[model samples]
Target: MLSVYGVAPSEQLFKGTSEAEFPAFHGRPVGGPVLVDCKVSIVKLGSHALGDQQSWVWKPVTQGYAVALENQPLSSLKNHLRGLRTLKDESGQNRLWPWFDPRYLKLVLRGLDGDDLVRLFGPVTLFAFALENGVELFSQQDGSLQVKVVSKC
Candidate 1:
């Protein structure tokens, strides 16, 4: 369901079946790749939100950065996004938006591929269960939407 290596799979990094990929990465000082629990850390950003890839288009609603994202501006968000696409765990590799950033800030994912869905996750958006880590952006203009993150824990 996620990438443990924080980036796309390198042939060197592809240790086993794809089914085992986790959501986070941990590199050993010795060399090569290793997977870590990429589980989403439970955080309440409080009752704050804004327009995202999922709802209200370009507008502000009950919006505020999650506590984890406090003061995290667009540049900070870009830094976080970079981490997702870089795979230091592998012998060698690079790609655009290879992995997912678990902690999201204000910016939206602009050009996610329909197939490479790891690029589409965000603090806002809804793609059904077909998509992972979705946050529905709701507006009075768009009726009601609910957000739910199931804890694999």
Candidate 2:
């Protein structure tokens, strides 16, 4: 099974459910919290869904709105991801990190060192993102990061 997380820019573009979704806040909240509808959501994809929408899903992924990872248990993975939602910046202030965004993900994969990558990846054995004309695959081997690109045919 593959774990997929995505964000819809607008409500009209959102077709998924709110079952396992959360709001994407800009920064740390100040006074009383204000609630608003969010388009961010997570879903698990099995072989059947992947087989059917392999072409469909890849397009949006290439546009940097979503991402996929493998080998982590659902509950644990969700918790792990939740833990990563906030990051401390240079000034030691909490900031929202949309790690699921493919654009941000690409930067993270390239910027982080081996040790950081290991922690960031956690139990995810494989990570994939679609490019303009190909798919980028990331994995770890012998304490190193390995990347491969499969061009669309």
Candidate 3:
């Protein structure tokens, strides 16, 4: 699993340390919350305190730079989400493990423009996308409430 930062799905984390807009830690906003998409394979499930897991041998997923395009929001229609529903793959081909929880994350993509997807996302992948300190999400939703997108350390 890999983590990314940015509004557009194609955008990735800052190339170098000096280029990171935020601290790469929780509770920090690097940009305005405009729908950031993260990989579920980057998370460590079945833990009390789930922290980010990165490794030297483990590299982040490559940007599906060639297959990404913004479409209509997934919730725009009733059960429309079920129309092109998917898990794991960037576009419904990638399947996720059972240990992961969709309640903690979201699959509200599709509205995002692009076709490039994560060709090789690891099992530990997870993400904390577009959110504010006080973003309000219903109990039915995963992750924190509205995320605040601001520059972090």
> Residue 78 of model 2: what lDDT?
62
Query: Backbone collision count in every prediction?
Result: 6, 0, 45
Name the candidate, 2 or 3, with the larger TM-score value: 2
Compare the candidates by lDDT and give the number of the best one: 2
Clashing pairs in 1: 3-22, 4-22, 4-24, 24-38, 49-62, 49-63
lDDT tens readout by residue for model 1, 1-153: 111111222222222222222344453322223232232221122222222212211112112122123233434333444455443324556423223322222122232234223333322233211123334331111323334443221
Question: Least lDDT summed over 10 consecutive residues: which range in candidate 3?
Answer: 61-70
Give each model's whole-structure lDDT.
Answer: 0.27, 0.55, 0.23
How high a TM-score does candidate 2 get?
A: 0.67
lDDT of 3: 0.23
Candidate 2 residue lDDT tens string, 37-146:
23455654443332223543323544433335565566665676677666666899876666555566667777776777787777666666666666576777755788
Clashes, model 1: 6
Off by over 4 Å in 3: 1-75, 88-113, 116-133, 136-153
